[model samples]
Target: MTKEQPIGFIDSGVGGLTVVKEAMKQLPNEHILYLGDTARCPYGPRPAEQVIEYTFEMANFLMEQHIKMLVIACNTATAVALEAIRAALPIPVVGVILPGARAAVKATKTQQVGIIGTIGTVKSQSYYQALKAKQQEITVTSLACPKFVPIVESNQFQTAVAKKIVAQTLQPLVHKQLDTLILGCTHYPLLRPLIQNMMGDGVTLIDSGAETVSEVSVLLDYFQLANPNPLKKRAIFYTTGSTALFDEIATQWLPITRAQSKKIHLGGTTNEI
Candidate 1:
């Protein structure tokens, strides 16, 4: 695969932009094609089977774009669909869970680590499994913060209501005295300040998006897929839902130009070009 072929990234919504932001910083010369399934936003509450189907639909769409590689940017989708996507696709497929888990284990000074993510991610136990695979003695405490994604997507990170909801959702995990906290979901990083304030200064906040980018860097090198043009990279964003809302939030959080979103029907007779 040549570097001219864009890297593909897919998420249930705009959350994957966090991963794309990190990739822009790390792999500046590599063009990227990001797809956001905004029409069916919040894969957190969906059944595992439905999530898997949606994930495949998006992955196949990206494959149709001739993406050189695939990055499953959504934690819920990664948990439910990474393996299947990897098996179905010819290119290397990377996901956030394993990299984040490895980073969490490496950053933890104490054996006790805390994780907060969507219900689907937490239920899948992907982080717990990955952490245990590295060190059996490490203790993992996971909480399902289903409301956090919507709050960040709505651009309400610093609002009083958002803080209140965060406090309520994180109260259980805060009581566990964890020295390190992993922001399991890509959207959760936007809530870092609020989460850090609530968790205090001592707890280390791990952004999975950042770690996932590092893994992507390593993979690109291993596969000899690094772009030759170090300064001529471009990142493009697409969404199946509200382009206006995605553009508003993306401009505020990411350093990319305006996203050109196109409407897509799930499981219908429409093709993404």
Candidate 2:
């Protein structure tokens, strides 16, 4: 709507910060407003109706903040609710799936692509659908990594235990000899090193979060909403979970000075949060 307005980002948990981190690096002049539904996180196992409801609530909340654009940073939410929100909202809305799919398609030499996401996302076959919709001949393999979200949410990423967990959960995909692997969940990018190492050097790890920000830039220009002022950039993070934990992980993961987080509730009839 206006240059003063910030771009909104929503995820199941702190995983969305991966996108916010990239936005910070790419669009330093623009501010960010992030919301994470940590209280009811790991949307991978939830029903599509529930995921849609939660995504609507978060998007509605972000809309109330006057954001010029919204990015659905959660893969599960993007799979289930992206179209509905985009069709209903006036502002431009971006999702991580398409960008990742495009990268996977371009990165793969053998047309073999692997995707790892939450159960809900995998079950929905959103990545397969998106990739196929782009190029029907592309081969897509998908696996559900339900434990990845909880591990990252608890700030256990990059540890020996985390590495082992990732390797075990992703073992099935390893044998597929996938030339490109889509880190379908936003949280999965934090474990990039372990995933890359386990999947080996030949497999290119596609971070959907990192890719989504490029689309953000495109939309900003298309909408003529790109912020030109570089002096007053800011980012505000809110979680339906613990602010302390979100603050801690965000600080560790992002390149910003510090993450300012507060606890907020969503999905009520009134403005309860």
Candidate 3:
């Protein structure tokens, strides 16, 4: 739990980079260690037990790196594993749901908030519960956008087809009179442009990943783990799947030019990766 120790972030895939990007912007001195289980991605449609298993696998891998803290950047994983991981680990653990809910509650003028996430996330009702916990009278509407993850993972986020899918998938929330919409899944922010267009300018988009960084900053300060050095630090990214695709997405989405990435295998007992 040293200040120089990198903060670990894990997700089903590259979507967690959205959170890493914000952390880089807000906590420039802190180093980052990111892991994306791309091989078992889109935890959206998977069963809750399976999602919990996979989430723990990723957490175990990050814990090996001696990260000062852990951020559950994936909404599906956060829905199922945040508590277990927090209890198991000595370091502080942060999840994206609570921060996004707080942001939506603060931003909403009409008390109507819409949430879009994966099937597992929606089924778990984590966002719904979090929002209600914050403000009981707030109206919450949640939808599952399972297809959105594959689009971002494949780097098709800017394509015309992606735009159409965003429009069609989010149509139900457009007329819900939501003043604020929480991008419950970390992957959703990469398609933020399309989502904003579909929901119109009046609907404020709350990026849960970005919001999670704010919480991370607070925790870092409170725990006396904030890095004292001001120099920029290189971020390390590892994917259980393709390093090529993961690097491509990281280069496009992240602001740093010297981002380093590698491929790692998770299931075997050997540390072959």
Candidate 4:
């Protein structure tokens, strides 16, 4: 493994751009190769087995790029595939869930933590397991916001419709009066403003993307994989769906100049690379 090799990140779609944005800020010198399986996105609604397979394909592709480390940027994929990827890959594999759980545990003063993620993620109960593993006494309430991802992908983040959807999805948790809400899905952060407006000022909205980046910093330092260069590094993005759509959404949500997204078919062994 070369010291200057780029770190790899994978997501279901443009959602992972949130994680990449955080990485760019936290590790300015580290190069990154991001792959978004947008063609088969909304992994939230997919079966667990399929999500696992898709995540493996993406992880294997990134591994082929000789990435120094792998970051599973999708909460759904992280829930179903992180451990499997970690066991199979030689490099360090980091996911958004544990870091988010840790942050939520520390951020919540009331011991009531609310998590909103995709169906796959919420169903997996990864956050609940992780949070409990850290502090068994903490109360966890999880909700699946399937519509939230598409809303953000369409770039309807702060619109009235977006707020309405957020309010509807979050209404169930309001009575719980959570002190901290973990935006478990990477895409959820894009809806943070609307979510915050509905959840009120007392609740701390934890961005998993940001939390994951901090964890990545610690891991890179511990493993001596942190890029030593002082100059800013560039990031490359690839998508398994339409490049134009990915580019549009990415440019809107991230600090990307032009998304170098390309369409790829993930059906055979050739797709593994």
- State which candidate has the highest TM-score: 3
TM-score of each: 0.96, 0.96, 0.97, 0.96
State residue 217's C-alpha deviation in candidate 1, in Å.
1.0
Error of 1 at 31 (Å): 0.4
Candidate 4: stretches off by over 4 Å: 231-233, 269-273
lDDT of 1 by residue, 201-225 (tens): 9899988888898988898889998
Candidate that scores best on lDDT: 3
**Better model by lDDT, 2 or 3?**
3
Better model by TM-score, 1 or 2? 2
Cα misplacement distance, residue 181 of candidate 3 (Å):
0.5
| Local accuracy of candidate 3 as per-residue lDDT tens digits, 1-273 | 679899999999999999999998999998899999998898999998888888888888888889999999999999988999899989999998999998898889999999999999999999999889989999989999989999999999999999999999998888899999999999999999999999999999999776799999999999999998986555889888988899989999999775557888887441637
Q: Considering lDDT, where higher is better, how would the candidates rank from best to worst?
A: 3, 2, 4, 1
The per-candidate count of clashes, in order, stands at 0, 1, 0, 0
Expressed as tens digits, the lDDT of each residue in 148-224 for candidate 4 is 99887777886899989999989998889899999999998888888998899999999988889998899899999
lDDT of 1 at 211: 88
Error of 1 at 52 (Å): 0.5
| Model 3 worst lDDT run, 10 consecutive residues | 264-273
